[model samples]
Target: MRVTIVMAALAVLATAAFAQDSPSADNGKVVFDKWCTPCHGAVAPPEMPFGGDGLPGTSALGVKYRGELPAVLEERTDLAPEFIETVVRGGLFGMPITRKTEVSESELEDVIAYLTRNNN
Candidate 1:
């Protein structure tokens, strides 16, 4: 029927729209560089003391994980979207909570996309 055909067309259009609106990992990298890179970036040296030099968060995580996980945020593959969301909204250990004004919900979604890009 014509109605069935129209419904299928509409569904296809809706899927296309959703795909376009989905979070972009590329954009997420920009957001992460702006907000998270200062603390979680790989700029810090391995010998850098925690809180004494570059990338305190990286240093702390390095010490905490002790090679079990990646200290650099971008290289991490074990991060879950839900866990990232929770940590971003609620302060985790030394990492402070990220406010919506600072990093919008859309940006947060993008960040999650970027961080989880390597996830299988």
Candidate 2:
């Protein structure tokens, strides 16, 4: 079990190492708007009040939640970048992993930056 954890951590570090190498925030922005924007918004179910106006390709969660559905993530300011990347790569039960193909490395970083911004 310990070895598994270490291996996973190493793998995550490697991926993040490469992610840091990606130097295109513009590409990241595009990737975010396309994929991450659907479920990682700031509003909740009742507040934003999704009117069920989903067209094709829209996420089912988006219909019920906001674009920033993972509200708790916003609160975790001290969280590790690698942890966030892993969660995004291998999604939670309610969330789907945003594959590298779906979003470029820079794009993922940009989305993380955008989400972590202190707009509040």
Candidate 3:
């Protein structure tokens, strides 16, 4: 009886750990829309005299990957949470690093969940 109780407790702890790591994609979508949509969105208005100033990130990614990968990060099938966190924190190329004050850890987790929802 004692062994069974201990096993159940361990299982519950493990489940909680997993739950904390997954986060909520819905919340993540909100974060992405607020913080990332300006550059990474699929559509943008053509306000510039030369061309549209929207989807810059998408355009850059398209040129960088040469059509081999999707320009949208959210559409990609290969994105790890750790990779997302690192990029957001450290920045890449023209992208600026996000400060913890600008984006809390919890918000970052939500963004990761939204961007990587298609991975699974």
Each prediction's whole-model lDDT (CA)? 0.89, 0.59, 0.85
- Model 1, 38-105: lDDT tens digits are 89898865564434457777888877898899999889988999999999999898788889999999
**TM of each candidate vs. truth:** 0.79, 0.45, 0.74
User: Compared with the true structure, what per-residue lDDT tens digits does model 3 show for residues 8-115?
Assistant: 999999999987876778989988988898889888666557553567787788778978998888788888989989989999888999999988898898898888
Candidate 1 clashes between residue pairs 3 or more apart in a chain or in different chains: none
lDDT winner: 1
- Count clashing residue pairs in model 2: 7
RMSD after CA superposition, every candidate: 3.4, 12.6, 3.6
Distance from true location, Cα of 12 in model 3, Å: 14
Q: Best candidate per TM-score, number?
A: 1
**Better by TM-score, candidate 2 or 1:** 1
For TM-score, candidate 2 versus 3, the one ahead is: 3
Give the C-alpha miss distance for residue 22 in model 1, angstroms: 0.6
